[model samples]
Target: MIESLESHPPQPRPIRWWVRACFGLTSPVGQRLYFYTGVGLMAVKYIVEAGFIRLMTGRTLTLLDFVNPLLSSRMQLLQGAPDWAGWALILWSLPFLWIAASMSIRRSADAGLSPWPGMLVLLPIINLPVMLLLAALPHREVERPYGETLGADDVSAAGSALWGIAGGVATGAVAFAMSVLLLESYGAVLFLSTPFFVGAVSAYAYNRPASRDAGSTLAVVMLSVLLSASALLLFALEGFICLLMAMPLAALMAPLGGLIGKAIADQCRGRRSHAMYAVAALPLLAALEFFVVHPHVREVQTSVEIDASPQIVWQNVIAFPDLPEPTEWYFRAGVAAPIGAHIEGHGVGAVRHCRFTTGDFVEPITVWDEPRRLAFDVTEQPEPMFELTPYHEIHPPHLHGTMRSLRGEFRLIELPGGRTRLEGSTWYLLAMWPQEYWIPFSDGIVHRIHQRVLEHVRDVSERSNGPPSRH
Candidate 1:
């Protein structure tokens, strides 16, 4: 039976927009108002936060850090900042959270979707798509009411799924070509935004013909991402290790696109131009990123205590024998492992050759403080990895010089009882976006390399002397 609102009069619109939007939980929200207001408020929030962060620390907060404000607590920029600043950022987010939740819940109901999905706004990263999807969905007609679920029968569902997956795959392929083939760069647009756009397009395609429940919609989106990824492998565009490394990123970004796509399909049932506009914008953004984005040098340091004195350790540090076969799986899986070290001359002007599994790093000695400090600038370095591909040899662009070793240094400190402290620091450049995510991988590999060399030095130094003499 159809319900009638004829007998009951509607509530008057509140004068203050905040009361209407933030506190108007029981009322329905229109799609345009929801999207625009959400975007406008978010922009304002960023402006305020950016100004505050800059004022407090004289440091600009990256988009990744600003998106998730909780990161402020752990950020180095906020280290010396007043305790109230961090707390203030946290407190500032509360009202926005309230506004988001309240708006999402109402918007979901208004769009004929269940209000439960609205709570997803609380989750980091995932909430972005949820909000976008909610905003994309058109408000349900007044007669349809809020409790109804939207979907077609199984036959239509299958057809939509197939089309959705195809659409998503095509979107991903195009994005891959534009970013990799044309731009020849792997920025966030390729790794992060593409998957999201693909997912969104897939979900939108799936629901365009006939709306599916959120579960079926998400399932289709996942399958689309999987199929698109498999296509890269099938066509030999990417290797297994690279794809495996990228899966987490793709998986993290895609579903939200699907959610929003599905919402858009359900609400604005006839808009074909919207998807086209999005598709067109992606390549332009990639081109802009190519011109604007540049990699920054990051340093990784590792230290080990040796049983022998600095004099003994210095001998091994300057030139070490071949390391034993690496037992670690990462090394076996093609990550470069240090092989040995050899020097051409004895002093500051000498050249050092550090051999790795892939090739050699040519280092020109800049400092030669015997038994104290040794530093060198890496003039030339070999490929970082050998891709585990089915093909005999595939030289991907990233393998060439994306991860570059700029310089390295070894510090030796004399310790009590004829001991030494050896510290190895490598400064390198990585051209990967969301540095927070990729830095760990590079840091971990660098640390392992440092450990291997340091341990070898320790062992060699210990063997040089008959035995350690305790005073």
Candidate 2:
């Protein structure tokens, strides 16, 4: 009997209610359960998020801030927050959002309604009323058969994959057109929402032909993004470096999209999925983000010690000779490197011209406290970098003014003996959303720029005269 039982397939383990509620694809959630559970979970999520934000920022978030659907106010809060806060909040709340979405979809099925309306839970402002409406709706006793044939077997796996890729690429192209070509935005909508929908739409389409396992869906979504990236490169729409820089953020979001896609595919089976139409919202969101949100100023400071006095270092701080051709791979890879600097006149009101491989920065001297501090306002700056692209060159919109240096200052602090501590700070604005993700790159690049200039100053000052008299 034991041998026979072993030979026979064992009974499938019963899924717990909580597990089904949280992650089940085919479970139908009744109205009373869905309403109370959703409300309670949402409340818990809000309280937890607010508490975390309070702890991280030392500032309390009001209920108004929590319920508001507008991105502007939320982004402003994040702007003031520590670099890790936004990312932490996102990581924290993703599960809540996922649970809410799943419950909504399942609740719709219980109410004998299209699961498409349930997807509104992912949208803002509208989601509140959607939940209320879903809660009020009475459950209908409809017995839907599981795993009913949807003609998926008719289409081959390779064909399904190809269709998914095409759909994903199309979605990305539309986003690129709206955000880059039309509105000239490099904000969160383009960076965050686009990748999400790309993964979602692609996964939905791929699974529409035949629903695959989670791992397969992830693979398909990743492949889709890779193809979309290739499309950008081959079409000369974006360069290698820009795309490479974007990859990390894109990678972070795309898998979540894939998971959502897979969820929709698994849950909304036998019903036509509304994922394609959902992608249409990308342009509208982009428009909203572009109009309401603007880039904020950020500062980066880098310091180095030199075996020279403040007076000797001050001379090089004002203007320096040509730097040798950059040996850094990033500089060689199209990031502009400082070549030389020249000053037209003496003291304050003098125009200091700093030359980079790409072009010049026209800086007007504001303070010229000899041997101590040097400050200037950048009136004009050239292209941040030349994009590494095929063909002659492609002038992507971001290269022009996305990153701007507003002002800069160099401080020379005298230390024991004859050595000096040189600190360089640049105040700039980066027109990118999710500042936490991009700030590090910007800060590092700026630091590199500072290092090149400061190091050159050190070499020159140490090798030359001890101290110079103020003009």
Which candidate wins on lDDT? 2
Give the least accurate 10-residue stretch of model 2, judged by summed lDDT.
144-153
Off by over 4 Å in 1: 1-155, 271-273, 468-471
Could you give candidate 1's per-residue lDDT for residues 306-381 as a string of tens digits? 8898988998999999999999898999988998999999898899999999999999999999979999999999
**Residue 125 CA displacement from its true place in model 1, Å:** 17
Q: Mind giving the per-residue lDDT tens digits that candidate 2 earns over 237-277?
A: 89999999999767877887777676666555667557756
> Clashing pairs in model 1?
133-260, 138-267, 200-257
Q: Which candidate is the best by TM-score?
A: 2
